[model samples]
Target chain A: MSAPDLADLIENLRRFADDRDWGRFHTPKNLAMALTGEVGELVAELQWLTPRESAAVMDDPEAGARVRAEIGDVMIYLTRLADVLGVDLIQAAQEKLADAALRYPAP
Target chain B: MSAPDLADLIENLRRFADDRDWGRFHTPKNLAMALTGEVGELVAELQWLTPRESAAVMDDPEAGARVRAEIGDVMIYLTRLADVLGVDLIQAAQEKLADAALRYPAP
Candidate 1:
């Protein structure tokens, strides 16, 4: 599949959520907390695996599918919450970097 | 000061970079590479600190200042990079969360 811009992907997902009538559940507080919970679940997938083993699971087809699903869930909530708050995730990230450069310009 | 929206924050930073004529240096490749470098530097700060020590440093005035500076740097560059590509950082993050929720769905 072609790599659609993330913005478009997000728009599509938002529509999906809205269709499911799930948008009502996506309050910023709930979405943010859910993001953390999903991260916890992702970490749980490799709780006791050796670093190498954990990495291995990332490549396993079934496990990879699950992981990818988890990742998609996280992204969906993040996009919904961010849209509600009117912040641009990528731009915010770059601003952080720019601030870093100014704070610690090449020494 | 009241927090301006992150979109505004990013726009302002972009202007700052443009003022410095540094936008030329922010090709996605360079920005992404620099982001990794800055993250490495931030990690280097507490490379060997005990978890407790690391936590302490987070609250220490001087170290906190430097850490915040590093974080700001990270945001600035991230914003700059995201803006160039026209992606919204917050929205992207939320999308990730939404995707995660669908993946895990309170299971």
Candidate 2:
């Protein structure tokens, strides 16, 4: 199957919100906050685990599914925030890497 | 300026790793763990805010900058995780919405 596009995902999210009359509640600030909240849930899954143990989280099927769902939650909110703010997630990521390159140049 | 592309961002990250001989440390498991850690940092910024207060987070310039930086961190690690696993983030996001649609049909 073909992969999804960023625009399409944003559109779907927008429509989802519009359908639920959640547009007003989805301003960038609120969306960003919600994004962080979802991220917290994702983080909770790995809390207190040693790096090795954290790395093995997906070894358990149920835990793996939870992680994936949390990832999806984080992604959905993030995409919505970016959309509200008119930030292109991929583009912002590329620019951040460019900035990082300047900070940590090849040795 | 033109927007950045996912493939380009992935390439830049890959090059950054290769330059540091850090490829071995960037396995999918490690990246996923790092992603959650960064997400935790992002969540900390809005930890105690009520919805209204949370929505005003960006109203404080310093806090706004911190929030943005944390967002950048989360994005970078997430992108890296997807790259390591050969998952197309945009596509995966799209498919996720499709699955969500089936679960939460429009009313």
- Taken over the whole model, the C-alpha lDDT of each candidate is 0.55, 0.72
Candidate 1 per-residue C-alpha lDDT over A7-42 given as tens digits, one digit per residue, 9 for 90 to 100: 675686677667667766665445545645654454
Best by DockQ: 2
Strongest candidate by lDDT: 2
Model 1 lDDT at residue A99: 56
Candidate 1 lDDT score at position A43: 47
Where model 1 places Cα greater than 4 Å from the true spot, the runs are: A1-107
> How high is the TM-score of chain B in model 1?
0.85
lDDT of 2 by residue, A2-106 (tens): 556566778889998888788889865577667767766766877766666656666778876776666777788888876665556776666667788899888
Q: Candidate 2: what lDDT?
A: 0.72
Best by TM-score: 2
TM per candidate comes to 0.50, 0.75
True lDDT of residue A7, candidate 1:
67
Model 1: CAPRI class: incorrect
